[model samples]
Target: MESNKSGFEPKNIWIARRKKQLRSAIIDLLNQYHEVPKEWIDEYNNHTIMSGSIIDTIIIIKESSTNCYEVQFGNGKSGSIVYSELDYEFQLFEATSEVEQVILCRNKVGLTKDKSFVQTMIDWLTSIGFIVDVDNGLRQTT
Candidate 1:
């Protein structure tokens, strides 16, 4: 017989006051910059690639709202709706990949694919005065 064992230790490297200062600084930085990274916009502009529009695919975390908003997954590049073997919508993998690359291009971009990421994003957005409804993911996704 064997018993499960766990080893974990919490470490505090910074003083509470110093941590507060650093946290304030980060929040200030985030609040000041409220635009999608220009690198993505510029790159998208330079490339004439198509199949879907950014409006339909990009998960724009707009100001005052915290929803990873995106349109319904329908209509393939070939103008057909696809479904998985289990009767779920089969997202256009290639197109969705492109969208993810451009919108979630940055390390901070959280998405539905990762719940932790989405919750982290919600917290950050909330701190920045955005109304995040994480529970409404289905509504937002659709």
Candidate 2:
């Protein structure tokens, strides 16, 4: 066989920077407009969407004094919780997708699944924040 001149190697790109910018943008949107429940911040910070996947968006929330959370959106048509096969409580998928529509050659109207997953997640975390711990007084979800 002929001697190879150079080994196969992948090219480097500025994907991380772009992702960081996107993350910052989403965070700003949530922080400025979305009423994110504080309890979900930690979980949101600790979670991230798989790179190279068709992720719609990601948000970072501050759950507690020392915790941050990450909320990711996916390409699905609606919100669907994906559970782990091994552990029922272990969430594997929390992302949601925007909706689309088809016309019938006439006047048509449509609506996408209102980012309900995000609101629901915030609600759940907010509710969890009110839980009382027998040993540690009241504790947040983080």
Candidate 3:
């Protein structure tokens, strides 16, 4: 097994690189398809994407005090109730054939805390040409 400067195995490094590519593609698609605010996107790119964290999902929320948006990664379960007012949330997962499966939710504050949000996400994913299954949250059909 080959290792890079970080000492990560070749497969691990490849996975990391692939995740970064997928994250970029998802962000680009969001900008293309949605009317997302530039500040929100910028924060995600700078704080979340550039941080090199293996994030399963990202929640962009508007801070009540600052009135500015920020990126919160992971499952979006932790944080104060006020901070949980999510403006947007998206999950990126690997799919077969280099295409990434994306599950997106928008404009629902505290949506992540609700168990029913899974069904909501499934409905949205199916509407946009992704197949949801028990094992994999989503998969895109070629």
Candidate 4:
């Protein structure tokens, strides 16, 4: 196997470069999403997995009846709702812990359909080259 000047295998170097590209693409996607509030981006930029504080997963639950969206930021084990939107109007607030957030989301959208909501987001992330662990939510795959 060929090695680079840094003594790293070529395959390892390629993998590292690919991971960087995927991370950049995911960040770009988040920034372009209108529903993601500026505060979330600010917070994300200030932290990282290395610091033990990063927005590991983003759960967007859509209330079918009201056509509203509840956006939550998950850090693997727990999360909180950071933003919500209805009728094209949105509000930003940090309320409730992951347990409460889950109950609220279930009450609004029901548990039976919640997987689809999360899976859809996961699918999109995968399509964009971001590796996701369905069981643990999003993390720094690099």
Candidate 5:
């Protein structure tokens, strides 16, 4: 996702350029202090298992050297990535304590963009003791 420094309009979804820069910086910070890996999986059958499963296209970052984070992106509406022989919906479902943050990103053009979805996702993250926020920038959340 991409956005400009002027901030996104009510009709845009991609990460604003400024937000993207902040996210990259946060990722870099996490990498500097912990093992930051993307798209990891168990070795058994190469199943795409990260922290937990949410839905058909969302995967929660529940397991990592740093902490827990639910990084949601892509939609089953499009050609969403799939994993596991069981064919589980790959959404970030698990609200684990190990996760400290939740990062959600989407194309912004095709998603529901409903605050309910975002709030629900945030509720889930906060319920499990994690800092939750849209991946607009690296603003810390309690």
Candidate 6:
């Protein structure tokens, strides 16, 4: 689905600025890690999120110095990649709310891929005082 970063008031501005900030920060990181391989971007990232009918987008994990998160995938195996290391593949999804980005990673995790990730995301967002809906990809609520 197309992303919805727009909203009333200064929110749309804030989201736009945040997205720029993150992209800049990640670019700086990439400059520092110049030798990072294409494999990490292609092989590791382009993998399908799940094996079967419930499959969704091809997924990648990303982190930044400001954000480090992990997700469970395949028989409890978990992996994380620095957000800056995401390459061009993740730019679209990662540009959304950071919380949503992490939830996407979480959804891609684990063989079962159930609602627990959604539950966890709802808890996290609510804890931070952001009324968000996980099923809606953490879109802020009115």
Question: Worst lDDT window (10 residues) for model 3?
Answer: 133-142
Model 4 residue 125 CA deviation (Å) reads 15
Candidate 5 on 81-139: residue-level lDDT in tens?
A: 11222432223332224543232322111223453333444444444433222443322
Span of ten consecutive residues with least summed lDDT in model 2: 130-139
Candidate No. with top lDDT: 4
- Give me the runs in candidate 2 sitting further than 4 Å from their true place: 1-12, 34-73, 81-120, 123-142
For TM-score, candidate 2 versus 5, the one ahead is 2
Give the Å error, residue 51, model 6. Answer: 29
The true-versus-predicted C-alpha distance at residue 12 of model 2, in Å, is: 4.6
RMSD of 1: 16.9
For model 1, how does the per-residue alpha-carbon lDDT over 15-60 read when each residue is reduced to its tens digit?
Answer: 3344345334434543453333434333332231331333221232
Model 6: per-residue Cα lDDT over 16-85, one tens digit each: 5654454344334343533233343232222322222222212223323333333323222333332333
Per-residue lDDT of model 4, residues 1-142, tens digit only: 6545786566645655654654566556554432344444434433444345444445543332343334454543333222223332222224455444333231122223445544444444445433333222232211
**What TM-score, over all chains together, does every model reach?**
0.20, 0.28, 0.28, 0.31, 0.21, 0.21
**Total clashing residue pairs per candidate?**
0, 9, 0, 0, 19, 4
lDDT of 3: 0.39
lDDT of 6: 0.32
Name the better of 2 and 5 by lDDT. 2
> Candidate 2: lDDT over CA atoms?
0.33
Give candidate 3's TM-score: 0.28
Candidate 6 accuracy as TM-score: 0.21
In candidate 5, stretches whose alpha carbon ends up further than 4 angstroms from where it belongs are: 1-115, 137-142
